[model samples]
Target: MPSPLPADLTPTELVELMQRLTLEEQAELDHLLTAGLPRWLPQVGPQTDALESEADIVFYGGQAGGGKSDLLLGAALTRHEHSIIFRRESVQLVGLEERVARILGSRSGYNGQAKVWRLPGATPRILEFGSVKEPNDWMKYQGRAHDLKGFDEITHFLETQFRTLIGWMRTDNPSVRQRVICAGNPPTDAEGEWVIRYWAPWLDPQHPNPAQPGELRWFVTDEEGGDREVPGPEPVMVGGELMTPKSRTFIRSSVDDNLFLQLTGYKATLQALPEPLRSQMLRGNFMAGRSDPVWQLIPTDWVKAAMTRWSPRQEKGPMTALGLDPSRGGADKTSAARRHGAWFDVLVTAPGQVTCDGPTAAGFVAPLVRNGACICVDSIGIGSSALDFIKGLNLLVLAVAGSEASTGSTVAGNLRFRNKRAEMYWRLREALDPAAEPPIALPPDQELLGDLCAVRYKVAQLGKAAAIQIRDKDEIRELLGRSPDKGDSVALTFVSGIPMPGPARQRTAREVPDWRVC
Candidate 1:
């Protein structure tokens, strides 16, 4: 027989029902019995909503510590029996594995897991863990059946990895449809591009959330190279009571979101290191400036002029050194700069030097070589392109080898990358300090200026004594809200200890017109 409909109780009825019950009964009614009911979930603001179609793929993207992962995990538990969770890195999966195991075993932890659980009178075995760091690792679950598949930190994994895993989740639950759930923060320097292309449209700020009523449409590609459009369904409010397909479901939760975030004060201690580290970790941001930024204390007006359209002209001097941030043809930028003793002239060469989006760094060095400058390009990753490019240039293209960069001018392989960056930071700090009286003027580039502003310094303690240490590269990336690669390249120029060159051709008073008089 069909279960009897729940009595439609009004606010008065609810109060009376609670008033008549005993303490134990009232507690049960308030929390255990009525909590999952749609009426009790609180209509304060937009609540947990679900996407339409069990077959559809859902993506939840934003800052860290948002209720995103928590919601995904809760939804996955609904299909307990055939739920598989995929994490990009083994380290992240290990954290999830430990949490799940703890819940299943008898423990002292709160019983929140059981309070929300409901099934067909059976404590069904639901949920499994898997990873895709290496494609072959997915082989272990060949015959696995899952109604729900969750990809945590989806941005970290490649698109191909996600597609391959979804194909494996063949579910048996007739009631529960097969679907994929993804949760992650925004893209970083290391993130791949396809995500920004497909998923970005749906979550990008430009698109109205909940998609302007009927205007909202979700599309899926089918077997035949054709596309079909589907209407976005109101989200299934998990407890079977409330159903909302409202577009206001997206919520931002940062380190401030997690109540448990306080447990990790180590991240907070990082603020003492430098401005770059403090900004990156404390507030989830990225920067191109590392401990030693390329453009330290550069004037604001200089950077503004560059952005406005400063023509790139060969400096009228002997270029002493060159700065290069090689690109791998992958979103990163390739940059080169010629340092004349008194001023530095930088060229983007390709549009992609500030963001990883253009020709490889090695591919952009011909100009510097022709100028007979000492080139210091990043030798990290596919930096070999820089090496090959420089060698082919037959000029003085040297590698900035330390741990990153492929250029040949690396330190004696003795110092770690962090240490080398620290050394550079020390030198930069010295130069920028008013007491040191640095002579060079700041360049006119936004990217360089922003890195300088975001940099910070802190003191480190060793037992009874304390010494100051510059922030690390990762910290710099976080503070700037972009990759600090260009800043690092600039920093390398300072560390190289090569003197800035003077003008190759002398300009007589006749050639140098005093514009002030005109």
Candidate 2:
């Protein structure tokens, strides 16, 4: 026989009874409060009672130990009869499911029946927990749509993987709006370009001050080349105005904002970190590892002063070859230089350099040609544009391919990109040294240092596990944001044919003499 119902109770009566649960339940609530709501907790709380707009997307961010999981579960519990919490870590997901089962499992409805719960709910079950750490597991999300979706530690999963899972959130109920809530800490790498570009606009530099949530939307370009806004709630608003059609909302939370993190544990955890991870995880700096262990090849001070000297100077002597590196639209950078057996910064043009969309290769090329500098640029993809401007000027454009070698090789140049870049970086590092007088002084350009800093290495595969690799394109693009046309041009110039000075060509009749004059 079923137990008797608590009573025919009013909302106030229900609240009182709910509050008067057994000591075990009270202890669990206290544990939840301590973990989820402490003042030192790293995420925002239920300060706003209003239901969020049915925006197509939403995001939550902050340091770890913030009641992010609890908030996500609580939000879903509001209107979602069925939900799925997608956890990247199996351990975390299992722990959460166990907690939910224990907390909401025993409570009886007014009818004195056990609260209903199911993993794969019937007729499209309402609640399920899934993991996405392994690539194949994402298969579970297919053909199964839910009204609510929650992702914990979103950054750990690949962007493509996350997108695939979110496709399952569609539901048939008009009144039941679908929601996709994601929470994570800062990304672990600068190469995670998508994260910074998508989230930077809405995140506060400092957290715990309560930020309005933000959303980033995309549109399909119409046949006429005009952009049409995709369907969704008015772009999520912040500061009383709807975000731009392409804007994204990023909610920044911190330990203090959580109002639940224990002060002693938070401080203890922070102190225990080995410094770099602590800065990134606790302090929330995406670029924290900029000059750390991987980049320890060069000291920070060497490049700090080198950044102040790179600028255009009046042409001196015959311009040698110009090296070029073409980019794929504004997504890459193009670099150029006239090397006298040494690299020099001629132009650093890209999207990030100035707020524009296309290549400025011509602008850079025109000046070098007028100065009689022969240019060499990588014309792979969209870089073919460089050819149009290269005509009539003494220039050579080459298509350079990234290293095809695999990871784990020794003798440096075995991996294409890092081999060439390692040499270039070494030279630049040497030139930047304040201690050693450089054979040639480069004009200071922090942008170059920024690009150099952005470059990262990867283990290249070379049939055997003996080759290593690192590509500079990503880092180079961050500094220039378009493509390193000028950077590539410089490298090419250093390796290409020399430029003979104008009106100073030698006659065939003149015999060459050796350095030894007898």
Leading candidate by lDDT? 2
Say which candidate scores most in TM-score: 2
Give the true-structure RMSD of model 2: 12.6
- Which regions in candidate 1 have their CA more than 4 angstroms from the true location? 1-22, 25-45, 50-70, 79-81, 85-125, 129-249, 252-322, 325-361, 367-374, 378-399, 403-421, 428-487, 499-518
The CA lDDT of each predicted structure is 0.48, 0.49
**Can you give the lDDT of residue 479 in candidate 1?**
44
Candidate 2 steric clashes: 74
Expressed as tens digits, the lDDT of each residue in 236-350 for candidate 2 is 4443445544323555545544433442347458657875778766776654653333644345445545444444556554455455554433333445555543335445443
Lowest-lDDT window of 10 residues in candidate 2? 509-518
Model 1 has how many clashing residue pairs? Answer: 46
Q: What are the models' TM-scores?
A: 0.41, 0.52
* Per-residue lDDT of 417 in model 1: 23
Evaluate residue 283 in candidate 2 and report its C-alpha lDDT on the 0 to 100 scale.
72
